[model samples]
Target chain A: MPSIRLVDVTKRFGDITALDRVNLEIEDGEYVCVLGPTGSGKTTLLRLIAGVIKPTEGEIYIDGEPASRIPPQERNAAYLPQQYALFPHMRVIDNVAFGPMAKGLSREEAYEISKRMLEMTRLAWRMNSYPHELSGGMQQRLALARALASGAELLLLDEPLGALDARLRVELRYRLRELVKDEGLTAIHVTHDQEEAMAISDRIVVLRDGRIQQEGRPIEVYREPNSIFVANFVGGANFLEGFVHRRLNGSSIIQLRGGLRVRVLDTRFNLGERVVVAIREEATGIVPSSLKSKGGRGNLLPGRVRDISFLGSVVVYEVELVNGEVLNSKVPIQMDHGRFRVGDEVLLSLNPEHLRVYPYPPIGLYRELEAV
Target chain B: MPSVRLVNVTKRYGEITAVEGINLEVEDGEYLCIIGPSGCGKTTLIKCISGIIEPTEGEIYIDGELMNGVPIQERGVGYVFQEIALFPHMDVYDNVSYGPRVKGWDASRMRRLVDEMLNMMALRDRMHDYPMELSGGARQKAAVARALSSGSLLLLLDEPLGALDVKVRIALRRELRRMVKELGLTAIHVTHDQEEAMAISDRIAVMRAGRIVEVGTPQDLYLNPRRLFTANFVGEANFMVGEVAGSSGGEVEVRVNGEPIYSVRSSLLSSGDVLDGGRVVAAIRPEFVVMEGTDGMNSGFGGLTDGCGASWGGRVRSEAFLGSMVRYEVEADNGVLVAVKLPSLSVGSGFRVGSRVTLTFPPRHVLLYPYPPEGLERAISIE
Candidate 1:
């Protein structure tokens, strides 16, 4: 049996559907992240798994046992929240040991367990300090230590590092994963941060409007998202509206709305079928329109630079194609800086390997394209 | 005239010194960003400049005029806060026009100005949308337009884009910069994000414990930092211990783990900066180090002769796809793990863990700082 399972679980807050028929399965010791922006019902899903809330319709099972039959306290799952969730009045050690002590461990045993968890989170030095005395990151680590000290095989984290700085978030996310795996814990973390979800999770469950949009490995969702939402949400993507023109050599030739032809793999489309071709911002290389690139170019589109911005490690060039299709290319900072400017004509070479083709969405596909 | 100047500024709250004595100059129409970690007094410095709070012991000047006693409004400075404070009842158009209306501008002029500001922010289409109906990014743009509508001589922004998503922040920061530069509005922005500071600023002031540690262009801070904090804060760097072996012409030979490593002697440093056999730290960006012959689709790197990148063999320890860049941790022969960053575009990230490869980089990107550096541990805390 999977460690946890959700069979068409749905939750409603009066009229609004917070989570709509969400189905998922978490294997033993697997790290899964429920990722979505605000109002996407990520928290509702985590709460449902921890038995904190009941589904308006459908079932949830933990360890092959129906979860609704179990009370929240009997779930034996540790829940850490975005608010640090530490006892402000208690010292760090006591807060971490609170779980073990309440779960019937001896005083000495609880202390011992807390100490080990603290060391794992690098919060051993602050064991004697109160929660308010620690930095935001330190407090977050303390919360993780508390969750680990509880001896729960399943750990549920809700936006665990939302309050920390960017640098601190990067450093602690890996540490959190290490602590979870080393303890042989099955974890389900929820967050809105795309980078945070991609950095630590073994599997990502993308949710929107109370339903699972897509679920896959982080890289899979990023490089080849199954839908338009996943592509734009996980990473920056360029969407071009096109139709399948023909099939040749195990690939489909796509014709853009402007009559430019490009080749793409995965031949699951019919002739003249309208599709949206998704290309990642970093997959395209830019060059002056006058010079041809040595890299084999299968799809070169000429465009005038519409906008360019310096982003420290990278430069983002927003090129508007001659046919008025806007595409973005992210060039690394190490590349020559003065290559292209606004109004300068440039050619974007798109590699076919990075192209992802999907049937045009039923509604609001154009709206989402502009948002991406 | 200089847009703003801080002379020996310091702010103390009770027994704690929020900002130490600091001096800085902002040129007219310059986008200067002040950045540091929490408790570093970035907020206090911004407040002192904007007259929200008084500096305990220093002088502030705006446009060459002594502004020590000038009121916040009379100082001709517009301060946008971290959180968007839109008038809840007003629509986007009215919220933007509120500034001009408050200044008693004629109805026609106010309407025209609001339209222009909305067009510049790309919010003209959403001019009729309420605060609740707009996304966080749109609301933020409305707030920026409102600040711009005030038409102050100087703009003080305190992490205005801090509360948005990564992609939204990236998009809005550039727009903010474009609007600021197009309007020729001198601005001072404060943020804890090094990337944000580097992206939008004409110059950056790195703060530590409320004091100005260093101020320079983003390229200067990224390429040749005067201190370890500035280097690590602005960008990712691999810090390794080394000793100066010999110097000749434009290159200096530094020894790391008994291996000769040539580094370009930075013209920014004093000529006698490093003496022979003196210990120092070599800081280099991960992207500067080139991994040799990574030809497969996994990583499109290939064809580098021995002398191209001061070469060394290393095994791939681990790798991660950080969206924009692929980070590979390589364990060198000396038992040190060097992190290399490759653009996520061309490189297919085919490098597998445990693969053997050679690593090398040009001597010019290497930065050698004095060993046993003063306050280095405190400045660039790895934790």
Candidate 2:
């Protein structure tokens, strides 16, 4: 497996910058997910690494060797586009064996490899079926089998499971991870799905506006996002605008609007500095007003349940605070127990450790506030 | 406002039956969501109600008035397509005012109504910008504003928010619900997204193969789904084929591959209705299944025998980290692989692959169904 690296990479389409001074290093045999929204240059970055697009500046290296001079065919990387471009007229086995045949492998050898790959992708039974005859998931598996048959050291997957349904996506994600690990292939997957990236990636690189916003393990990125964009994009977070009141040992106490105080575990900002606290819905616990007498360790805000929504396994409660701020809390739906209904008085407590504090305001809000 | 009703609705396109004999009713001012996968007749149903397509055999009523002869323009209903279909050359203000202008409303009245809609959708600042200049979410809001400016009492939205991202979808879902309720307008939204349907709709009608599988409030549909299709499609479910063993106290005990699972009773099922030791299927949600280690000694066995839930032994196959919770795929010796989700904070990440664990699921959380339903096999085959 080859480790891929991009140093000071810059790409521009006319006057628009697609990638700006991007520096990324993917370790050998590591599953790295490049996550970004649509038109965020995620696909451009993958194409650059695959040698399909040349960077306007800087160089890309594979296994410590400069790869800019190499053509896509010689880059030893398999690129799977979003639309799983399987050969429409070819059968599943023929599509998978095309890669091996292109590399001058004997017909018998290519067929053997193709058969093994098809079996691995659970498409053995459909080997004789044409792409048009197979389901979407099966066609995608054929695409994957072809990519594997290419004998590439690094795999570039751009929204590999984007076209599948949710259940099929979940099942394919597990199977893809297993395939990558079993083959010890260095894979870089680009997608906008936070759940898919988190479920399959060993590490995630969150990109926005053609720049790296944050890069870390999925759990770490979700728990402690470095910027408001990362927090809001990765998961649903309720942003509370506040200013740091005091700095305790290894923590900061933030006083939000309406004098509601919240203790955050991070001390990245100085006292009296403006900050934003991102509290995930699942981390916020709702307690009865009568239990308000019992003090809690974390920050507590009094609010009224504005709406109660049941979403299968979880119940989401939208609480409107005294300051007119709305916060949501998600808890596992307990059918036997009585749930909190709308218009009920409730207290929402945020665990300091679960709270992630960012020094910057949200992207759009920042400009709006600055104008004021 | 009008309460819309469809009786024995059936639509056909040549040889294809687009909509089967489906009956549904939408109360006045109620937000109803028609949810299903692509080609499941959700959009066709919406078009039928919008007067775009006449049903092959059925009667549509609006406030007790038959709507078969109603033209598209005279239906007094607003329609929003999945694609914005905005007049790209027109500015935001003109786009919203087009409906009022076509109705020959005075300029002053049209301006006032359009302005109110723009403000409600939070598009006031972008009134001067063309459709292409606005973002996906902004364009969708603009389209909604235009649809509502006609003062239609009934609104039909066909995947209005399907093009936006997750964050924008959530925000717009809340906004749409608030706007619908605030205006006291009866609306039917067609979408394939379960979260969007659950988040905004007062009631959900889940469709399958052109037929209505289940219709209920989001809570009722989520909590007490009657059929296996409803249970699996509305949310995540682990289905296991088993045999009916016995019953007691509003519960039925099912035996699957020598493992007993307790399930709540359904009106379609009974103690004697299921032949003794007859084959059946049990569907359980991941949230209902709790994992306990063997070190707890009697803890695993005790929790099951206490009547709180049913317990079974399984080996952990893999764990997927999903932000707030870790989902584990466990393989039971009974030939069923079930998923269990545990809160990240409550459970330590120590379970290794192949480690045997016990899964406990409450009886109320289980949905029992007969084995091999007719249309269910077709659905699985399509998958």
Candidate 3:
């Protein structure tokens, strides 16, 4: 197993700096996902680690050895790009077996390894088929199987599962993690999907504008994002602009426009300090307006449902507060839960513990939330 | 107003059938989404509706008029594609006005129409910006405005949001649907994303193997699909092969892995043709699988426990946190891996990996279907 360490790495092209003083470390056999928006320089970081491109500044060490000048072929890192390539002349089985065979294994041993890898990828039935005969999804799976069979100590994958169907993607994520762990291989996967990154990664590195915004375990990042951009980019959250009005025991009351107020379990800000309260849609709850009379929660905002979208596992309700601020609350579907329709009066329940408080951005809320 | 009708439409390119014997009706002012895997003829069907390619057999009608020999320009239909190709040199205003200008319309009318299109697309502020300066979502909105400026009552969109970022795509799809509904235009959206189709369309049509498998409202298609292909395509379902054991009072018992599992008898199964010992399939959504922590010791299968349906013992193999929900893969005693999804708010439910648990599938939630003529693997395969 091999660990990777980058110290103050910076990559520049022409007048543009793709990476700015990036420092990161990957433990042996750990799965780390790099997630960001489109122009966030995710691909550039992957390329720098794979040795496809050299960093303009700082050093990269593989297992404590400076490897900035190492050629890609000599790095022994398997890189899988978005558009994967396969040997068109070789059958699926032969293509996968080529990796192990190149490592001096016998034909029988290589074929056995290839078969196991193909089975894990759900491509065992098509082992004898050529790459030309398979669909785009099948070909993508074949490429992934070949990558696993290569026996590389480190794997660099860029959107490896983007081409497969949603169902198959979920199934393969488990298999991919299991295979990586079983082989004790270190992997760094780059993706634009937040849910995929959250589901598969042991740790997530949130990158924005070629800079690391936050890095932590999935739950920690989701529950407590450090910045407004990280809060919005990783698992979208609803934002309410307010000012800290009063401080209590481990809590503060935030004053909003139109005389509305909400309590959050944070008192770090001074009184009258402008702040923004961010709550995940999943953290918000909804009930009938009639329930306001039998109210239980303290942070209840009465609103009218503007829209409802059924997303299979959960239904998202867009509520327009009386003050004209729209907030979304995602409720999980269950047989017992009451369903709300568009144009219905409802009460949105916000738990103080689930609300996150942040200082107002100097650049304004809209600019801070922009991915670019 | 225009409503499209296709009867036995077939398109063939020298023995390779792109679409075969398709029949569909799109009502006036209705939004219909055609969803299927790639290479499943979704694009071909949409192209036929747009009059880009003529059907080899059968008939196509628009607004009660035959359209077989009509040219695309004369069809009075708007088309938006996955790739946005606005005029590079022209600003947004000129690009949107190009449609009305080419129709020989006067300057006054063209200007008014372009303004309305720009306002509806929320692109009026950016009308002076060139294509290179606009974001991907804005550029797509401009293209849509250009398509709608021609006053076409029928809109055909093929993967219009496929090229944008995930967040932008989600936001734009809602805007597109709202605009189409606001204009009262009949729309046919073709996409490969199931959640997008479910959220934005009035109804969804599932196509496969050059043919339409099933069509229904999003709720109907998701909750109660009439075909096996529709269930597998529209959402995630856990399917188990079984043999019919008995039936009574709108319920059936199926023997799977030598265990009797109860399910609700579907109308197809209650047609009096299915008898005992017949091969069938039972499916349940992961959300319906109720799981609770067990004591790890011997536990007998029970018929009734806290209102939970048929109960079985299992050990959690893995768990994943997917934003709003938690998904667990549990390996049962009989070696069947079952997927169960629960809300993430249940943080202390204690069904961790390797924890013994009891899984219950409510009878009402279990759906019964006749086994397909092909094998189960091929039946659910996307390609």
Q: In candidate 2, which residue ranges exceed 4 Å CA deviation?
A: A83-86, A91-97, A100-153, A334-338, A362-372, B270-273, B296-308, B373-383
Q: What docking grade applies to model 3? A: medium
Residue-wise C-alpha lDDT for candidate 2, range A25-100, written one tens digit per residue: 9999999999988878899999999888899998999888899667788878899987667888888889999999
Which 10 consecutive residues of model 1 chain A have the lowest summed lDDT? Answer: A290-299
In the range B1-383, model 1's lDDT, one tens digit per residue, is: 23898899988889999998899999998999998877789889889998989888989999989888788888888788988899889999989998788899999999888889999999988999999999888999998899889878588999899888877887799889888888898999998788888878989998877777799988778877898877777777887777788787777777788766678734544556567877777778888777754442323333322245366777887666678787778988877678888876656656777888777766877887776455455557634
lDDT of 3 by residue, A40-143 (tens): 88999999898888999999998888885576887788899888789999999999999999999999999999999999988999999999999888898899
In model 2, residue pairs whose N, Cα or C atoms come closer than 3 Å (at least 3 residues apart or on different chains), thus clashing, are none
TM-score (C-alpha) between model 3 and the true structure: 0.95
- Give TM per candidate: 0.91, 0.91, 0.95
Interface RMSD of each: 2.4, 4.2, 3.1
Supply DockQ values for each candidate.
Answer: 0.49, 0.46, 0.51
lDDT of each: 0.82, 0.83, 0.86
Report the lDDT tens digits of candidate 3 across residue range B1-383: 89999999999999899999999999999999999988999999988888899989978999989999898988999999988878999999999998888889999988888988898888989999999999998999998999888789999999998878777887888888888999999999998889999889999999999999999998888888888778788877888888888888867888888766787646667454358888888888887787777664211223222345577788999887777777888898877788888777764336678998888888877888888889888888877
Candidate achieving higher TM-score, 2 or 3 = 3
In the predicted model 3, the residue pairs found to clash are none
lDDT of 2 at B207: 89
Which stretches in model 3 have alpha-carbon errors above 4 Å?
A69-71, A125-129, A132-135, A335-338, B270-274, B295-307
Q: Supply candidate 1's per-residue lDDT for A56.
A: 96
